[model samples]
Structures are given as structure tokens and as C-alpha cells.
Target chain A: MDKKISVKVCLGTTCFVMGSSNLQELIETVPAKYGDRVEVSGVPCLGLCSIDWEFSKAPYVKVDDEVIKEATVEKVLKAIDEKLNK
Target chain B: MAMNTSTPKQTSHLKREILVRLIKAYLSDDFAENTRLIPYDMRPKGSEVPYRCCIHSERAILRDRAIAGLGFSIEETEDSTLLSELANKAEKRDVPEQQPLTVLTTACKGCVPSRVYVTDLCQGCVARPCVNTCKFGAISIQNGKSVIDPAKCKNCGMCVQVCPYQAIQKIIVPCESACPVGAIAKDENGHAKIDFEKCISCGKCASACPFGAVHEKSQIIDVLKNIKAGKKVIAMIAPAMIGQLPCTAQQLKEAIMKLGFADVYEVAQGADITTKNEAEEFEERLMKGAEFMTTSCCAGYNELVDRHIPEMKPFRSDTKTPMYYTAEIVKKEHPDAVTVFFSPCVAKKREALNNPNTDYVLNYEEVGAWFIALGIQVTECEGKEFKTESSAEGRNFCVTGGVAKAVQTLLPEDLPTHPVVIDGLTKQSVRDLKKYAKNGVCDLGNLIEIMACTGGCLGGNSTVNAMKPALKQVTSYVNSSKSIKEQVSGTEQVKQ
Candidate 1:
């Protein structure tokens, strides 16, 4: 019931190698500012490129239902900042 | 002064231009003189794996015919520029070209009329029959007039027909009428269904599908893992990749490295090797009384033969494709490293997976999608040099006759032999080749180089963008690089 935002990263062959797995490690153990409202997870290929874009780009991650490109620790945090009010 | 229709001189000049452009686009062969050929002991173990360097040999003929249709001369310099300019007009020229209507019905809703063009003659019919016939009750009378209930009407034409006035028009979407293949079938809800079997994968439907529901597959997820693993990943790039990418080949390689691949290698380099080996193999085959020899570089062409010309199976040369061959060498050198093949062909998916050496194979279309999915703009990575071995012969593998040109280096100086090169292997051409093989009347001199698609890998089904000019650009790019000696030496700034 707590208002926790979950970030799921695709560790499929493309994402994991493009540093998605590493990015997930970076996302874990959040800073004090966000407190316990955030959580991170790793998932399989969401078929984003396959069904949505068709291998035009990659290194993607998803926050709940939204997709983020060029997935990195900085970008994911920035995305988390935009969605949540400080 | 005669508006010269029969200008053989002009036509021959134009033909040269076309061939040059084609040579640039296909970029099939390089290193016609010197390159290592694969040893016979390492040939692919199963029939599932393609053994020939030539794919779709018939398609080469299509490219030749397309070039011949222009009536240009190979000897003319000016014709070279013109042909190169138009070499990859396949999809470009086809943009305005529409598909037939039967296929169109698969995706389109029936035409709807633009504003009710009700005639002035719509008299206040005493019967009120038109309004009564409207099932949806779309027609309604305005003011004192007996106007139909427009909102309730389903636009079934029942109202229009009921009205003695005859007033109704429809607007249609051109896309719905363009697909000749019934692959694009409509659903009960009016969306489209893409039957893969029915679909020729011609992409006409994707182009025409206004909603953009149908699309090519993506392989970004697969590519990302190799980059992050931090292994010595070598990207074996297809020759057509030279100019088509927004950045130069070096820059694209740099961008890929920035994303984290260990190194980049050109598959054309493998072609340089393949050409020499296959030429030698062809000679040996002829010596052994093997009357017919077909190049097998093209996976689709191989599939075509397997599916259509089972009898011609013996004619296909037993050489692994350049991609596979190069992967094999890389695999041997860096036992722990992974190799990724970046090609313009979709069938390469099948090719890469089957090759024990190729860790992964993703076409240009899939890579393009991955770029979008990752939000990595290739332009941002521009100007970065993606380091590679300098090999001119390997780089020229992007065009038609490239294999033949490359193999010519292996042929003896005075061998009295004639080899035929076929481009764009269509269904008809394969049948023709079979006929020639069966009749023993083939003038190919027992050796035929076949590319399944029109421009070989440049014309593969999975490519993300146009590949014509890219072929020429890569050839020049290859020419600027060091000779084949620099590729295998692995001494060009080798990093542990």
C-alpha cells in the first residue's frame, strides 16, 4: 500500500550488455532523499525493440509502465526525479 | 541532332554508370589477388549451414538486367556516376509505386463520404422512407425539413438508395488498395492481420499500413549484453554499412565501442579470404568432373535452392559465408571473446545462429531499433573512429560480381575458364539455372556466382534503410584502407 515506485530493467541480451545490469546495481541502495519510496528490479526483454521500435535503438529500461532509453544510473534517477515530487 | 533514341554510345556510357553504381552498391568482392582461403577440413558440418559465399545468384542477374535496362556501358566513366546514383533505386523508386487493391482491403475500412453531399432534389418525400431505412438513425430532419438522422445512420447506403435523389460520396485511403498479397487481412474490429506465410516480406504493407502496426524485429537486447559483458567483442560489419550510417564506418565503430564492444572487424575481409578459397575450390571441382558449381554466399539463395531446387544442392559450393568464416577465425584467435555480426540482411539471423563462431547476428533494421530503444543517437557518437584492420579486398564485399572479382586473384594467369555471375536470384532465374544444370548446356563454364537478393547483402530483407550509395562509399572507404595484409596480422594497435 506504500507509495513505492518500482524501476524494472530489461536484462535481455541487448540491454544487459549495454550496461543495463550494471545500471541496476547502481540503482539499488538509494540515497536518503528518496527514502524507501523507490525500488528496482531486473526483467527480461520487454520486446520493446521487437514489437515497438524494431532494433532502431536500445539500452532501454522501464519505470512501471513507462519506457526510458539509453538506460544509465544518471538517466534512470533523472526519470525517477521527474515522476516523483521531491 | 536526331533526338538520338538509338545512341549505342550514350546507352553504353549509361550502362557503365549503372554497373559502377551496382558495383558500388553490392560491394561483393575485394582482394581479387591475395587473401587466405579457409582450409577444406573446417567446412561446415551440416547441410543446414550454408557452404557458399554467393547467396541468391539469380538476383545478380536482376541487378544486371536493371543495369542493362539503362543501356549503359561498363567502359564509360560518366556512366559510372549515373549508375552509382541510381543503383539502389529499388525501394526509393517503389515509394510512389502503389500495391494492388485486393491487398489493400486487408487493412482499410471501406471509404467514407466527405460531408453529406445531399442533393437539392431531396424533396420532402411524403413517404419518410429514407429516414425509416436508416438503421443507426443517423438522419434527422432539420427545421421543418424532413432531413435524415445523420448521427444514427450507419452510412450503409440504404438511406442514399432509398432517397430518390441519389446523394452520397466516399473517400478511400490509397494504402488499402496497394497490397496485392492477402497477407494484410482485416480483423473483425477492422485492424489488420499479417500472415507471415502469405506476406512476401516485401514491406509494402509496412509502408502502406497507416497505423505502422507491422514492423521488422529488433535485436537491441541481444547486442547490449555483448557490450556489457566486457568481453573482447568484435563486431563483424557488412560492407554495405560503410556509407549508409549517418557517421563514417570508423565513427559508427567508435560509437559501438563507446557503447562497449571490444573491437570491430569487416566481414568483407572474410570475403577477401572466401573469394580465394572458393576460386580454388571451383577449380578443384572442375578438375573432379563436377560440371556445375554455384556460389552459396547468400543464405536466402541457399534456402531458395533447398526449398525450390533440391536437385541443384550438389552444385552449391561448400564454402562457409564470409561472416561465418571471419567469426571462425576470430573465435580461434580470441577463444574467450564474443563476435557480433552487423549485417543488412534479415536471413543473416538464421546464418549467424547456425555459425558456431558467430555469437550473435543482428541486421541493420534491428540495430536501428536498438538505437531508438536505448535513446542513443548515432549522431552524438559521430566522428569517433571505430578502429578496424585495414583490408581493401574485404571491404569491397558489398556489391555484385564482388566475389568473382575477388576470386579472379586466385585464378591462374592464363587459365582458359569462363565464370558467370548472377545477381538478384528471382524464382524464375533459379528455375533457369536448374534447367541449365540438368541439360548440361550452362555456359557458366561449370562455375556460377549467385547472390540471392538483387544487391546481395545490400538488398537483404532486414536492412533498416537504403543501401545503394553505401555500397560505393564502402568500396572507396575500403580502397583507402591498408591492404589485406594488415587485417590478419592483428598487429594494427592490438589491445590485450
Candidate 2:
């Protein structure tokens, strides 16, 4: 059995303001074969905004504990692909 | 001087977010139970106030915004019911009025009247040209400055012109300044009021108002209700929706289908037909020795001509809009289906009101919110490759000069067709159009293309992205399409 990938999206105000409100929708379009293996959840403020690093931006997403910043639909999909292939 | 940067863009985004959430809630099974508490849930007592004086006022404004989103204008009613109650009543109504735009008085800052005022630069010139220019004794020397009497001043700006120091400055209300036809004015209470009779529903005022007092009444709830009732809702996607979402047009279609829309059709298909028909009409008109002809694709420009420039009406091409043609095709294919034109302009909302073929209009912003609320990621969706026979020229109709270019391409190479493209409508452009209308012909061009919004439909008020990038995306998309010959052949095959 394939291990399920848990994906957490930051719903912080900063992230929401940055147009991350619709990132959850990306979960719905996962191919039917990988549907069960993917789990998507919305988490309030992953606290990425508080970080001082330049790479740490709002709209942070964590896929199986791997944090991705400035996440777009394509970027998140690519991340999911990497996880599924691994 | 306000600390809040409540620009019109931010205000529009905020309103769209609330509406999206509300629509999502309405679609849920537990909608009836939780409908009343949406405003409070969105804005709690302890939450930070973004725009208004306090959290309560902010919540109140949100409630009113949500009400406007649900397609009902908030009248000055004596009923003291909660906003949720009003939403409940609004949701149950069969259909909303045809009023496309409304003013949220609660959100209005009630700005000062638009007038010309004296500034500190007033040198109290010995010449006193300001006083001489004023036919009425409105200007007077007071405290080493030229003061204009508010009652006597006609706001004619003659004093502004005559003053060599340029001391006089015009303080314009943002909404009033944005309106091309002077339709928006202050009511007795100083709140921004829209005169529906004079308003062209161009949505310029809505985009111009810093307070975001003016709003386009949405038809999302009505569309949702129809979908919930198990009706086949066909989405006629406009050409302007090319790069609005973070997905290709094919992927966007698949995502829309996921939202319970029976199917999706591109309005560019209609644009192809319009191009052919309009080109033929143009040639016929020119042969008959008629003056220059204008493109009729822009509903805002059409409304402007209808309302203001009456003489120009005769010269406008009598071609039905792309949405009209597309909706007709949808109706022919599925007689039972309700056709909703997914547009990128506010004027189309008003256009849809009079159009029997198109049942409803949803702007790109509302559609984006809907996608977000439904958790339908268009970019992630496997693109459903529907065969499109639309030409590059037809698909280019979303940008400035696209219509003229398309028509010019269809015309014979030898024809004397000089195209004049009005990239954006301003007071100056309107004056030029009026000049052409009065003079019958201008040396500039015999074929005129007037786009109300700068950069055409991509720069429409409801568009999500800025103009420059969106234009690039649209141009690339158009370039990628099939040639005009191939498209015409495919369209003919479809008709047969």
C-alpha cells in the first residue's frame, strides 16, 4: 500500500491577502489514481510570516513535513509529484 | 489622512472574499442553520478593524457587501431585522432587479462636494484675472488668497484657467471623477448616489472609489440556485478570461465542469462569426458611401453612444456581441440549459439584462471566488482538450485593436481600410468620437475601434491581474491559436 501524503496549507491573514485562499482547490484536481494517497488540510498561520528569512513568505505549505514557501498551484503540484514518485 | 490603505483594489478583493465564503456556505447542506452568523464569524468583536471606525462597523459593512453580492440592493427600509435575516429573504427571492450597480451608503465616507478651491499658491495677483473671468461675482480677494463662493461658483473652472499662478485646484470626488457620463453625484446626505437612468453601468466609479462604496450587484446566488435545482448550466467563457485564473482555458473548463456546469463554450467561437459578419457589413456600408463605421463589441462603448453620443449610434455596426452569438449556439445545442456568460466587465451585466439569450452574467472575480470556495484548483486539473476552431484574430478580441485587426484581416487586401484604434476611452477620446460623428469622416481612419477600458477586456474592472502582464498572456494565447482559414473551415463543419 502507498503511504498517504499529508499536505498542510497556511491560511494566515497574510497568506490569504496574498491570494492563497484558493490553494485548497488544487487538492480537488489530483488525478483519480493518486486521490487516496493525498491528504489536504488547511492550518491557521503556519507562523511562516514571523520568520526573518527572505525565503519564508506567506502562503507556506507543508507536504509531509517539507515546507514550501511562496507556493503556487504549479509549485505545489510539482512538490506533490516529487512526493508521490519517491 | 486615514491610516487604512483601503484602496479600491483591496476593497474589491475583500468583498469578493466574503462573497465567495458566503456562496460556499450557501451550497453546503448546513447553509440554513449557519447563514445568519457569517458576518459575525468573519468579523469577531476582538478582531482587528481594517477600514471602518470599529469592528462592528466593519462587520456591518461586510453584511451590506454580502447583501449586494447576493444580487439585492439595500433600500432604505424601516425594517430593523438583522443582516442575516435580509440575506435569508434575498436568497429566497425568485430573481433580483436588473440594476447592475448599487451604492453602499454605509460604507460611503460622504466626501465633500467636487469643486474648484483656492490654494496657498494664490499670489493675490494685481491683475486679478480670476475675478475678471468669473461672469458671476464668485471670486473675491480674502486674506491674501482668492476665495470662490460655493453658492455662486458654477465649477466651470474659468477661474482655474485665468489664474496665471495656477493657484486654483479642483478637488474632485473620486467616484464622480471616474464616471464618464457624470452619472454619479452626491445625494442630499452627501453619500455617493448613482443615477441609474444616466448611468451606463461601465463600473468605472466602482473601480475609482477609494472607499469602494460602489459595487456591482452579483448574480452568483441565482446561478448557484439554478445549478442546485438540477438545471443544466452552460458557461459561455469570454475571450477575456484567458489568463484570469492560474490555469489554461482547457483546465479552467474542466474545473468549471467540476463545479456542476454541464459544459463550457468559448465566446471566441462567437467572435469568429461576428468578425465575418461585421467585416461583410463594413464592406457593404463603405460601398454605399457611408462614412466610417465603429466596432460594436464593447457594450460599455455601445451604452455610451446610446446615452450620450446619439449621432454616432447610426454608424455603429449592427452586429450582435460575441456573448449573444455564443449563447445562441448553446441554446441551440441544449434547449433546456441556462446559458451564463462568464464576462470580465460590469457593462456586460447590464447587457445581459436586456439579452434574452444569455440568462445571467458572472464576472471573472466572482468566478474566481466560486472556484476558491468550491476548492476547485483549475491549474491542477487535467485539461479537457475540447476542439476549438477559433482564429487567432477572433481570440485576440479581448485586447485593444483586436477587433479592427480582425475585421481588417477579413477585408480584401486592396480595400482602403484605415483602422483607428481608441485604446481607452477618456473625455478626450469621446470628443474625438463626437467629432467623427459630426464631420461624417476623419482622415485618421475609416474603421474605428473603441475599447472603453484601457487595453480592452483584459483591463476590465472585474479582472484579477494588472493590465501589462495580462495583455502579454492574452497576446501569447492568441498567437498560439489556429489560422483564420482553418478556424473558418472548422466553424462551417460545426454548423453543418
Candidate 3:
């Protein structure tokens, strides 16, 4: 059985207000593109913005163990491909 | 303020970040001092200059953004004045200034004046449809290329539409084009300037500008100062708030209280009164042989009627807005309480400025920033029921057809209302309304629901969430609430 990659899209206030509201399409689009190989879900804040508080690079998404900063639809998909090949 | 319901842009992100930073600084121990560091902190001395020509230019625009965030008019603000001085002034100001929006000259792209011109694609067809379509003698074929005389052109765009090759194009200044009324135009500097007399405070210009140059002078510091003074600060939340955050309305109520609000009144509770009064007014108007009566809850639409379309006066319902009624009730209950209206758009800021009862207007974005500043996760907050619950229809006043539907439900039997919702008034729709008023008859419908922002109040400039989720959240919240009919009859039964 192929390992299913987990993706968590941050819907936290900071992230949503930043730009994750734009990446919401990926929740549906990722599932259709990669099928059962990847699982995508909108989660609450990952607490990543607080870690680097000086100047926030918000709207972060998590692909498996990797935390993608300033996440976009294309960025998440690319990160997923990198993992699948690995 | 990012008003686009279709997609939230990067400019929206930048705007939110500035607000968040400003609020954080305001909440800090040294508000005036920390506020000074906002532009520098956001863009450090040696940081990467991602947006503009240089780091200095980016910081200049950010400084202007902070000034707007501090609730001062950018156009009137001098470049020499420091941000700390503005912060101090914002804290001391008795009332907000004129013009809800201010143009950030530093950020303005100064888009070339919007005009019709013959593009390179013009084949200079012998058909001469371009010349024939030109009513102002603006188009002439010269050197085998169709040229449009800018001086003579009225920019009616008829030639652009009639062109066979589709070569004729209208280059639009986004902010200028977005205005339903021709309120914003370029000065000799080629930057945008708003005419206050013609402006309606619809915030269309703010949302339309990709440059994010148009800014709503925020009233955040005023609300915060009052809160800090240990005054009885009451929050009158708008109906559109149900869709803004990831929480139930009840949860939001609790979350808001955590922000130090003495009590939070659901504006929906007041919307119940508006719904009833508008229904009574509509019925009376119809009985008096009036062809149609438009809903008057939208502040932007009211501004249009006041300034641009006086003809719409008789047709417009005389009922006060839900915010007005709600603020009145809040004042009556707590005469000494500092009343702050939590709204979805800048139009309400203008509306609040006119009303004596409304002390200040805080938009959804500011509220979201406040939540972030205080680290209050609305989704995690325990739900606390509102003391006065609003009916489903009253709660639905945020959407386009809500007001008309509320009125129609009351007159469902005898005078079945034919509702015609005017979603997002545009140049064409504004003209249509004028015609309806001039004729004193509307064949389209007997009830007109005019919302200035497309998709109603939820699609306001200050809203954070996208359209679909916001709609879904609001719909679920409405479905759980009681109906207006049930509430009205319940009151009658009690009175009897």
C-alpha cells in the first residue's frame, strides 16, 4: 500500500487574514489531482506565526513533516510531488 | 479594506498585516512610541524590498498605511508629521474627519487617464464603422491607422464596441471605473482625488484599486482608547459578522466579550424592528397608490439618495437602519455607555458619523485584528447565548434579498410583494433607479432592495472570509435561529 501524504491548511486568524483564504481551493483541488494518495484538511492555526514573530511569513501549510511558509496552491502541490517521489 | 468577494488578494494580506501590527502596537505599553516603529519594523532597514522600487519607497507607503490605520485622513495628513503624532492625535480626536477614504499618493500607480484609443490591432477597415459610430467626431483614420482624438472624445465607448477587429480598447483607471458615481478623478499630479460632494462612501474604489492606494481612515484607536478608559463600552455587532470568522454567532458573542466589551448587542435584534417598520411603511405606501418603495437599510444607498439621487427620496423607505435602531436601544438602556458599532464596511463609518447615538465604527477587519492582538481564538471560545435573540430573517439582513424578503413575509397574503433586489449598485443600475423614480412607477417590482456592495453586507470591504464559506456559515446560523413571524406573533400574544 502506498503511503498517504497528509496536508493541513491553516485557517487560523493570522493565516486567513494573511492569504490562506485564497488557498482554500486546494482542499478540493488536491484531492481530485492526487486522488487517495494525499489527504487534505483545513485545520486551526499551526502556531507557526508565533515562532517567528518579528516579521510574519504567515498562511503556512503543512505537508507531512515539512512546514511550507507563505503557502499557495502551486507550492503545496509541488511540495507533495517532492514527497511522493522521495 | 479588501472588498473582493471572488478572491482575496495579496494587497488584502498586506493591509491586514498593517492593521494587525498597528493594533499590537496600540495594545503595547508604549502605544505612541511603538506605533512609530510600525513602518520600520514591518520593513527592516536591510530587508528585501519585494513590492516597490526600493526599501525606502516601500516603507514610505507602509508609513502612510499606518497613518490610515491610526484613523487619520491620509490626504490631509502632512508628510512631515510623524506617525506618533498621528497616534496621539487619533487618541485625542473628538470625532472622525470627513471622507471615509483617503488616497495614498505614494502608493497610487497614477494609472493613465481612462480613455478610448485605437490599438495596434486596428486594421483601419474601409467600412469606416469607427468613424460612423463616433458621435463626438473623435475617431479619424490617418496614416492607415485609426486614431482617436483625445480632446474631442467623450469616451462613450461606442466606437470600441463597433470596431470589427476589436482593436479599439478602453484603458480604465480601476478606481475611477469602480465608482458608480463619477466621484474620483485625477488632479494635475495625475494621482486620484475624491470629490466629497459626489462621494457615496460605497468603498468600491478601495476594493477596485489593485495598488491598495485607497484607504479607509480607521477608527480602531478611538474604540481602544474608550475601552482603556474603563468606560462602559458596548459592542453592537452587525449581521454580516456571522460569516466573517470560523465560529458560531454565539461563540463570537463570547469572544467579543473577552475583548472587554461590557455587553454585545446583536444588531440583528434591532434588524427585527427595521423589518417590522419597513413592512408597515411598504404597506402604507402601496395603499397610498405608490408603485414601489425601496429598502433604506444600506448606508451607501442612503448616501446616494441624499447626494446624487434626490428623486429616489419619495420611493426610499423612511425607516432608520438596524444600526440606528440598535444604537438607540443601547443608548436608552445604557445612557452613559460608550457605544461602538462593529460593522462590515466603511459605509457604516459614514453612517455612524451622521448619527449622534453611534459613538464609533469598528469594521470586521479591525475586530479580527483585535482578536489576533489579544489571541482570542473565536472557534475555541465557549458559546454564550445572546440576551436578546434575533429572528432568522432579521439575521439575514446581511445578504442582498434579506430586507425585501423580511417585508414580503409580513405582506404575504393581501399585497404579495414583488421584490426586485438591486445587488451592488453600478452606473447602469443607478441610472435605472433614476428612471424608475422619474417615471414614478416601476414595472419591474413593487419592492426594491438596494445593497451598495455586491452580495450585500457580507461582501463588504472589511470582510475577511471568501464568499462561499461566509455564505455557508451565515446560512447555517440563520437556519438555527427563529423566524421573524414567530417572534412578532410571540410579542403580540404577550401584549394581548
Give the candidates in order of TM-score, highest first. Answer: 3, 2, 1
Q: In model 3, what is chain B's TM-score?
A: 0.95
lDDT of 3 by residue, B351-457 (tens): 99889999999888788878777777777888888889889998999988988898887774868578999999799999998999899988899899999999999
Q: What residue runs in model 2 are displaced by over 4 Å at the alpha carbon?
A: A1-86, B1-8, B76-81, B121-133, B161-166, B489-496
Instruction: State the local distance difference test value for candidate 3.
Output: 0.86
- Expressed as tens digits, the lDDT of each residue in B1-496 for candidate 1 is 4111111121222222222223222322421111111111112133122322333322232233233222222212232243334333321331111111112221134333223445556666667676687677666666534564456545466666676656433232323333333445555656455554444333434333433223333333334444545567777777766644445676677766655677777776677667656877878887787777787777656655665566777788887688877787688778888788887654565556467787666555445434433445454455555334536766666677666666665567676556777876544675687797677557656567777556655655444333434565666786787665444354442111
List all candidate RMSDs to the true structure: 23.2, 9.3, 2.6
Evaluate every candidate with DockQ and list the scores: 0.02, 0.04, 0.51
Pairs of colliding residues, candidate 2: A25-B375, A25-B377
Q: After superposition, how far is residue B410 of candidate 2 from its true place, in Å?
A: 0.7
Writing each residue's lDDT as its tens digit, candidate 2 over A1-86 gives: 36789888775444544445446555556535467788887666666655432211445788888988767767788898898887
Query: What lDDT does the true structure give each of the candidates?
Result: 0.53, 0.77, 0.86
lDDT of 2: 0.77
Q: How far is B124's C-alpha from truth in model 2 (Å)? A: 4.6
Q: TM-score for every candidate vs. truth?
A: 0.49, 0.82, 0.94
Worst 10 residues of 1 chain B by lDDT: B32-41
* Strongest candidate by lDDT: 3
Tens-digit lDDT track for model 1 on A1-86? 25778788775544433334345454444534577777776666766745532332345788766788766667778888877854
lDDT of the structure predicted as candidate 1? 0.53
- The candidates, ranked best first by lDDT, are 3, 2, 1
